[model samples]
Target: MTQRVVVDPVTRIEGHLRIEAETSPGGEITGAWSSGTMVRGIELILQGRDPRDAWAFAQRICGVCTLVHGIASVRAVEDALDYQIPPNAQLIRNLMIGAQYVHDHVMHFYHLHALDWVDVVSALKADPKATSALAQSISSYAKSSPGYFSDVQKKLKTFVDQGQLGIFANGYWGSPLYKLPPEANLMAVAHYLEALTWQREVVQLHAIFGGKNPHPNFVVGGAPAPISLDADTLAATSVNVQGLEIVKNVIARMQAFVNEVYLPDTLAIASFYKDWFRRGEGVGNFMTFGDFPEDGTGDPSKWLIPAGVILNRDLTTIHPVDLNDPMQVQEFVAHSYYGYSTGKDTGLHPYDGQTNLDYTGPKPPFEQLDVAKDYSWLKSPRWKGNVVEVGPLARVLMLNAKGFEPAVELTQKALRQLDLPLEAVYSTMGRTAARTLESKIVADQMSTWYDALIANIRKGELAVFNDAKWDPSTWPSVARGVGFMEAPRGALAHWIVIRDGKIDNYQAVVPSTWNAGPRDEAGKPGPYEAALMDRHTLADPKQPLEIQRTIHSFDPCIACAVHVVDPQGEELTQIQVR
Candidate 1:
């Protein structure tokens, strides 16, 4: 007999996600399903709206990755009008996006994903002196003293003693799956607190350039910050000499944390769980839109992360990705709570994408989703009819396959340190390790971009905004374009169709949608479902910690996946997850 285990509203992630697994009598998972229970009708809302104002609305897709959608939205409009921004503007965008990668990755590791590996209850048993020694052994992060870890332990003890765990509530605290020792767990807890303080300082870079952190202001042509060297104006008023100095300091601080803390912690923790490198290798194909353009946006060769697809884990050949090619990329709604104009089985390219809600699953508060019928709100997106995993791992693999020296060197060094083969990168821990490595790569690149920006400023080239196509009246009567970038989670692309200067149709195929979506018309399991099946086993199905470890590895941002609430407003299943 197969037992069905359900974990609803998967916590620590951005939005609601439910994971249902079928386990055999021996506890090995035989199959699984991934569902985004809610619907995000942002595309429907975007229709008939002014194309220039789309960024403001689109940026609200997810509060966690606000600026990513904003950047892609404006880029879509720019692509439609053939708008070209200044070199300095490109550098600034690169710096901002790079900062997001560093900030987002660090936070995800410490706050969101660390608990899966580090046992909090065990941390209370840890000797602060031993933790301090362990911290120092890894890297020279200044807050490695015994006193610092002691304080963190005391705070955690207070939470556990008070019968109120707060964010740490209902966790499988002493689960057998936790591999890190008491000292290592204590060390991680201390850094978790430190990162809380560190993130506030790092976000200053975003505020300095974009006028705010979350939902930062992004213009259609270029950045909103105006460059000036005038000493008379206040530092807050403009991007002056003082402002530039602060930006440099922020970049330095970001680099310091990635090197001294994030990278070391990831490797140290990963060294304890080598088995993870063999499991959770779902849908071996990988894809990346390729971010951080070194030159103008039009050329793919100049991109730091190249846009390409590697099928069946074949590093020998990288398939090209053409956004305009309708036959190449398409989305199917067969297993989703959506319908198509042509038919439910039909796959439509993003350019002609449709959002028609047709919920035919079990009502709310149900035990399991009707996997045989429509289940999730996320449409199954396919790259030439194959499921492809994206995000940091994909980017790193692409860089290595393309013979990018820095990425290749870093990947080899990591693989050697872990005593694992290159193929190990296809698993869950590989995703986490790849995130840390990419942070180092991106943080180092920020310094180069910062220097370029300073050089442009020193040469008296203060131009940031381009107003050539600011007015929608200058656009063609009918225009369509695709704006794509590699978000912190994975590949993200926005497709827009404009008619008479208004958005006729808009579709955002986000990273989470690609990774966490349901099955397609062909009955092929998506990335999340495929990973959970065959290899996963539940030591305790009630606590489902094993399920969370794999799901959180992808950093599922369901807020970016499903947005709109059903007007009928039926209360579905309510399950508590720590």
Candidate 2:
């Protein structure tokens, strides 16, 4: 008999996500479905709006991803108008994006995903002295003290004793699958609390450059901030020498944490979960838009992370991605709660993308979604009609395939530490490890970008904004282009269509939409669905820790997956966890 288990409201992620899996009698998962319960209609809101102002509205797609949409939206307008920003602008954007990677990756590991691996209940049994020893053995982080671990344990005990585990509640703490000993769990928990404080300091980098952190202001031509050297000017707001020193310090702090904390913690945790390196390898194909421009944003060759597709785990031949080509990138809504203007079976490129809502699943508070019918709000995004995993793992694999020395060195070092083969990089734990490795690479490059910016400023180059195509009045009647970058989670692209100086149409296929989308018209599973099917087994169906371990590996951000609310405003579905 096949049994069904559902994890509704998959907590700790950005937005609402519900995962359903059908298991064999013995608890081996036979099939799975991934669904985003809400709709994000920010694209439709951009219709008829000025192309110059689109970045402000589009950046609101997700509070967590913050400036990525803003960056992409501005870049799309720049690409469409053939506008070139100054060199300083390019370097500033690089530093901002690089800081986001380091900050987002570390936050995701410690706050969002660490609970899946570290058993909090087990931490109570750990000796603080042992945990301090373990932390010191792994890394030379200055925070490794017996008293610090003891304080963390006391705080955790208070939560449990008060019947308020808070964020740590509802976790399967004593599961057999938790391979880490009590001391290791204690060390991870300590770092988890420390990351909360670390993230606040690093995000100041965004405020220093863009004027704010979340939903930072970005102009279509260049960065919004100006360069200044006036020591005492109250009216003029700009990035002066003092501000530059602050940014440098922030970068140094970010690099220190990635090296001394995030990387070591990931390796230490991974050493105990070696089997995960064999499981959760979904859709062997991978894709990346390639971010961090070394020179100008227009040149693909100058991207620090190269954009390409790797099919069937092939590292030798890299397929080029032309976002404008309809045949190369397309989204199908066959298994989604949407209807295309043309037809349900037809796949549409983002340039002609439509978001016609058609809810066909069971009403809210229901048990399981009808897998045979339209199930998810996310449209299945396919690259050449194939599912490709994206994010740090994809970027790392692409870099390794292209023989990039930094990526290769970091990846090989990690593999050697775990005593695993190269093929192991395709699994669940591999995804987590890849994120840590990527942070190191990006953190190292941040220094180069900072140095370049200072050198340009010292040479008396104060040009930050370009007014070449700032005004839409001097533009083409019709223009369309794709703005893409490798986001923290995966490949993210925004396609824009402008007509008569207004946004005629806009479509943003975010990173989570690519990884957590439903099956395509041909019934091919998306990355999340494919990874869970026939690979995971539940020791306790009521407590689905196995499902979380695999899903968190992808770091699903459902808030970015489905966009907007219906005008009718009626609650369409209510989630029922069973």
Candidate 3:
């Protein structure tokens, strides 16, 4: 008997995901459909606006994504106008981006994804002293004392006493799938609260550089922060001696947590879930747009994370990625709620992408989405007609493939600890593991980037913005370019067309759009759908912890799941995620 299970609006946090899985009589997921219930209209709003101001609006696409869209938007305009920023601007951008990567990944693991594997309610029975021993056994983090763990446990007890587990509710707390002991659960929950405090400190990097966070300030040709070392102007600028020292301190804090806390906890937790390494390997193909440029040359080879595609899980041949190549990178709306001028089944390059709304899904108060027709708002993105999974796994595989020594050694070291071969990295647990490994890699390297910025400052290369193309008359009549980066989630790129000094067409294919999109023209599932069908079986149909595990591994976020309001200002869909 085939049973259809609908998990609509997943995640207690802001998510617009709707997963419908068809399970066999044995509770094995045979097929799955991933849907983004709300429309994405940010690109449409950018039409006819000043090209430079697009970043301001584009950055608002997602609140949790931080500054990724802002970075992509500026890069798009710069690429379109052939505007090259100074080396200092590039370095500043890298530092800001690197900080976000470490901070975002840490938060995702502890706050968003941790509950999927951890049994929160089980922590109440834990011995705080034993929890301290578990914490010390893994890493030398300073807060590993019986008293510290006891306090954290008390906080949990208070939440439970109030008739709710607070932020930790709605999880399969005592599920048979949660293999961690009481001590491990308590230790993880303690660190979860610590991460919330850790975030406040790291965000200072963005405030010092971009002026603010959660939609920071960004300029098209260069960064907004100016370099000035004079003591009188020191208080006004971010590149002075005082600001640099603060940045150095922030980097130290990031390194300490990733090394002592985050990485250790991941390894400790993985010890109990080794079997998960065999499943959730979705669409063996992967891609990266590449980011963190070291120079003004803007070459992919010089990038810290090299860009390429790995097909069929083969690391031998890494195919190159070209965003502007129409035949290579295209978006398909066949299973989506949008229409293309070429055809519904046709694939169009992002520069020629269309956002015409043609929603044909079920009406309001619907129990289940009709998987047969346009069921999602996200367009299926493909590289060379092959479905590629993007994010940490793709970038890690790229690193290992490109023989980046740190990534190669890290992967080998981790697999050796888990007592598994390299092939295990091709699964769901592997994806989660890859995110942790990369966090350390990026965190440690932040110091190097910081040092280079200091060197540039001492040598007096103080310019952060390029004024070469500031005048509109200097630009050509028409231009189009693609700005791309490997966001914390995965490959993120924004395509822009500038005509007559204004925005002509704009399209942004974000990370979630690639991973959570519906099927393509040939009827192929996206990464989430494919992974759900890969060795996934529901232990109890009522509590689908298995589904949450794989989905959260990708850190799924439907930034486009905006509101659906009628003409009279009433919400069309009253979808409450929690």
Candidate 3 lDDT, 314-421, residue by residue in tens: 999999888999999999998898998899999999999888988788776688778778889889999999998999999999999999999999999999999999
TM-scores for every candidate against the unseen true structure: 0.97, 0.97, 0.97
Show where candidate 3 strays beyond 4 Å.
232-238, 560-578
Per-residue lDDT, model 3, residue 276, is 90
Q: What is each predicted model's overall lDDT from 0 to 1? A: 0.89, 0.89, 0.88
Q: Number of clashes in every candidate structure?
A: 6, 11, 0
The superposed Cα distance between candidate 1 and the true structure at residue 37, in angstroms, equals: 0.8
Clashes of 1: 6
Task: Determine which window of 10 residues in candidate 3 has minimal summed lDDT.
Answer: 569-578
Model 2 TM-score is 0.97
Model 2 lDDT tens row, 1-578: 99999999898899989999999999999899999998777787789988888888888788899889888999898888988999899999999999989999998999889988999899999999999999999899999999999999999899899999888887887889899999999999888988999999998888878888887778888888898887453212678777888899999999999999999999999999998888898789999988888766567777889999999999999999899999989999999999988899999999999978788888899988889999899999999999989999999999999899999999999899899999998989999999999999999999999999999888999899999887778999999988888889989999999999999999999999889999998999999999998278898999998899889999888888875575587664432212
